[model samples]
Target: MADPPDLAVVSQPADLTNAWLTAVLGAAVHGFSYERIGTGQVSDCYRIAVRYAPGSAGPASVILKVASADPTSRQTGAAMGLYDSEVRFYRELVPHLGSGPAPGCYHAAIDAGSGAFDLVLEDAAPAVAGDEIRGATVEQARRAVTELGRLHTLTAGRPSLIEAGWLERGSLLNAELLTQLYTLFLARYREYLSGPQRSVCDSLVTAFDHYLALMSAEQRGLVHGDYRLDNMLFGARESARSLTVVDWQGVMVGPALTDLAYFLGGALPADLRRAHYDELLLTYHAALGPEPARTPEQIREAVRRQSFMGVIMSIAASVVVERTDRGDELFLTILSRHCDHILDTGALPLLITGG
Candidate 1:
C-alpha cells in the first residue's frame, strides 16, 4: 500500500475528485460517484462508488462523511467540537475498540478552525439503519444492548483513556441550558405531549440541577452520548457485525449506563421494553462481565437514574438541529418512548429524591 495521503480535508462532496480519492485511498481511482446517505442534521453522509484501476486494492464502496451544508448546523458542530471529537474517535479511540461495534475508519481529517472535516469509512451495506419511530424488534434490541455492553466494558475504568482530553471534555448541556430548552420544548411540543410525558418533563425540569450533579458524580467511562436507534445499523444475515454504530460526534466520558438507558428508552415501545427489560439488562450486564461486580439491582437502579438522558436529548436536539418533518416525528417518537421509560422506571421520583 502507498504511504498515508498528505491531502487536505475536503469540505464538501464536490471536492471529492478522482485524484484526491486515489491519494487518500492509496489506490488508483479512475472515477467515483456518490449519493447522499442518512438524515443527520449536523453533518452529511454519502455512499461513494469507487471505480478503481484494475487489480489495484481498495474498497469498492465507502461512506464519506462531511460537515453539514447548513451554516447554522456547521457552526454548531464546530463550536461544540463535535467534528474534532469524531475525528479523534477514529484517529485515537477505534483501535482500542477493536472490531467490536464501530465501523472501520479508512481516513479521518478535520480542520478545527474551519470545522471542515471528512471521514471515509467501511460501507456497512446490507446492514440497515435502525428506525427510532418504528422501534426495534426483540432480537435487534438484544443485539444492540449486547454490543453496547461490550463497548462499555472495553473502555470502562481504563485509566489511560479515562482522562483523555477528547473523551473527558464537559458537555455544554448543563442544567440551566436544559431547563431553558425544556421550556422551549414545552412551548413547541406541549400539545403533542401526553399527560405522562408532560409530567415527566416537568419533574425533570424541576430537578434538572440536582439530576445533573448526581449523574456527574457517578462512575464514568466512554459513552456514546446519543446511543439511540437512528445512529445504529443492524446487520443482515451474512453480515460480519450484528451492529455497526455510527455518529461519534457526541461521544464522551460519562456514566456508561446512560448509554444503555438512552438506547432502551427509544429503541422499543414501552410495553415491549417492560416485558423484555430484565432479559435485555441481563444480556448487557453479562457481556459487561463481573470486573466491576454490579448486581442486578444495582444495574437496574443505575439505568433508572440515567433514564432521563434520552429525554434531554430529544428536547435539546429537536430544538437545536435543522428541523424537518421527519425530525419532528423522530424527536416526538423518542420523547414519547423515553417518557414511558421514565414512568416505568420511576426515574422522575428517583431524580427528585436524589437516589
Candidate 2:
C-alpha cells in the first residue's frame, strides 16, 4: 500500500472533506458523514463514518476531536496549552506507549496560536462510556485502575517525555483563580451543596497554596488530570481492551497517584469504595511493577493527600465550561463523592496542617 497523503489540519467538522479523509486514512474514500459525540465541555467530538471505494479499505468509523465552539472555553483551552498537549500526546507520546489505555491516533495537528486542534482516533465502538452518576461495578473499577497503572508504567521514567515542555505544563488554576471560582461555585450550588461538602471546599480554598506546594513535592509522572468515569469508555463484548481512556487535553506531568485517587474517589459509591479500596490499590500497585518501588501504605498516603484534585476540578471546571443540566449534575455528583472520600480518609487534616 502507498503512504497516505498529507492533509492540512482541519479546525471544524464542516472542513472535513471526503478527499481529506481519504488522504489521512490511506484509502480511497467515496463519501463520509459525521455526527457530534460526547458531552465534552472544552472540546467537541464527532464520529466520522467513511465509505471506501471498491478494493480499498480503511477504518469504517473514526473519532474526530476539535476545539470547543464556545469562545471562553476555546480561549481557556488555548491559554492552558490543552490543545497543544493532546496533539503532542498523540504525535509524540502514543507511539512509545504501545497498546496502552489511550486510543490509537491516526492524525494529530494543531495551530498553537489559535488554539485550534484536531485528532483522528480509533473508534472504541461496542464499548459503553462509564457514568459518574451511576458509578462503576467492582469488576469495572478494577479494569479501569489496572489500565491506569499501565498508563503510568508506560510513561514513567522516559527522559524525552519528561523533558518535553508541553507535557510539563503547569495548571492555570492557581490559588487566586481557584478561590474566585470556588466562591462562584458556592453561590451557584449553595442550595445543592451539603454542609460537609461546603466545609471541604472552604478548607481547600483557604489552604490552596499549601496544597499546591505539597503536591509539587511529590513524585512526578504523566497524569490524566481528569481521570474519572465520565472520561472513560468501558469495554463490552468483542472490544479489544477492557478499558480505553480518552480525552488527553488535560494530560500533564503531575503527581502520579492523583489519577488513581480522582478515579476511585468518584467512580464508586462511598460504601463500595470503602470495601474495595485496598484490593483496588493492590491491583494498581501490582500492575505498576517494581520500578520506582512503592508500598501499599505509600500509595494510600499519596492518594489521600491528592484527594483534593477532584474538589478543585469540580469547582474550576464547572465555572469555566458551558453549562448544561447534565454538567451541573455531574459536577455536583463528583463534589459530593469526593467530599465523602476526603472526610472518610481524614484527608482534611493534611490540608489543615499544611502537609
Candidate 3:
C-alpha cells in the first residue's frame, strides 16, 4: 500500500481500550468497563461488559464505536465535518428510530472542536448469525432505504439543528472525498483493470465536475455517505430487510439516491439487484411523500441517471470487502470481469494502458 499520514495513530487494542475508559467511562467509574473485543480498520468496536451498576443486580453490555483520532487521518485524507454530522444525525433522528431492530445510541459525544468522537450504543438489537448473513440481503436493503427516506424527511430544509447546537449544514463534502475515492481506485486498480475499464474510469473522473454539478441541483437531503452492506446490521428479529443503519460518520446532505444506488447496485448480485431496483425506488418515494422540490418522479429519474455510479465503482474499486490477502485476489477477479463487461458493452472513453 502506502505510508500513512502522520496525524493518524495506528489502532492498537490496548491504546483504544485506555482511551475509551478514560475518555468515556473513567470519570464516573461506571460499572461498565470496556474491553477491546472487535478491532477493524474503521473503529475499535468494544464489548462494554458491565459487572454491576448501583441498583442493577447483574450486568449489562453495549457496543461502542470509537472514532479515529489519528493525525494521518486528517493529513492523508478524510471528509471534514463527517464526525460532527454523524453526532448531529443521531441526535436529531433518535426519536424516529423505533426499536424495530436498530441499535439505539445510549450516548454520543464529540469533543469541542477537536472532532474526537465516541458513542455509547445499545448492542446490536439482534446479533447477526454469520458473516455470510452479514452481507446485503433484500430485507435489509428495504429497511435501509426506508430509514434514509425517513431521515431526509426529518431534516429537510432546516439549515441548523438548533437543539443539537449545529448549523444544520448537513455534512460537508470536500476535496478529500474525491481525492480518497479516486486514489483508492486508481492505485490498486491500475495494475489489474483492463484498458477499457480504465478508460471508463478516466472518462468518469473527467466528467466528475459536471456530474457533481447536476447532482448539486437536486433536492438534497441527509445521505448515509458510505451506505454499503458491511456498515449495517440486520434487524434484531424481523429479517435482513429489517436493519439498523450502523455507521453514520459519513452522513451528508446530498441527492438521496446516492445511498440506495450504493447498496442495491454496489452489493447485491446484478440480476437479484436489478429485480428490486425499480420497486425499491417506489418504496423510498412512498417514504418521502411531500418534500419541497422532492417529487417521486424526479427521484426515480435520478435513480436511473446516476445508476451508472455502480459501474464506475465496479471497475475502479476492488471487490474485496476488507483488508486481507484474499481481499485483493477476490477484488481482482470481480474487477477483471467488470472490465470485460464495460469494454464489450462499449463504455470506455479510451482504452486504458495495458488492458
- TM of each candidate vs. truth: 0.95, 0.95, 0.68
Off by over 4 Å in 1: 1-5, 290-292
Q: What lDDT tens digits, residue by residue, belong to model 3 across residues 1-355?
A: 1111222321332444433443343232244556664323344567766544354342256676665434544321233555566666666665454543335665566564554565666666455521222245667667767766765555554535323434344323333454556677666667776676566566656666555566666555556655665566665664333566566766555665677655554555445555776777677877765653556667755654444444444433332223446445544544443344344334343222211
The models' CA-based lDDT, in order, is: 0.85, 0.86, 0.52
Q: Mind giving the per-residue lDDT tens digits that candidate 1 earns over 1-355?
A: 1226577898888898998888878799999999999989899999999998888879889999999998888888888888999988888888677878989887899876677999988888879898888899999899999998877777764657657776877667777888888888878888998888888888877787788788888777788788878889998988878899999998888886889988888899888999999999888888887774577788898898888888888888888778799999999998899999888887787766775
Which segments of candidate 2 are over 4 A away from where they belong? 1-6, 157-159, 290-292
Candidate 1 clashing pairs, residues 3+ apart or interchain:
none
Give each prediction's root-mean-square deviation over alpha carbons: 1.8, 2.0, 8.0
The worst-scoring run of ten residues by lDDT in candidate 1 lies at: 1-10
Candidate 2 per-residue lDDT over residues 243-289, each given as its tens digit: 88998888888887989999989889899999999999999998887
Rank candidates, lDDT, best first. 2, 1, 3
**Candidate 2 C-alpha error for residue 342, in Å:** 0.6
Residue-pair clashes per candidate: 0, 0, 16
Clashing pairs in model 2? none
Per-residue lDDT of 199 in model 1: 85
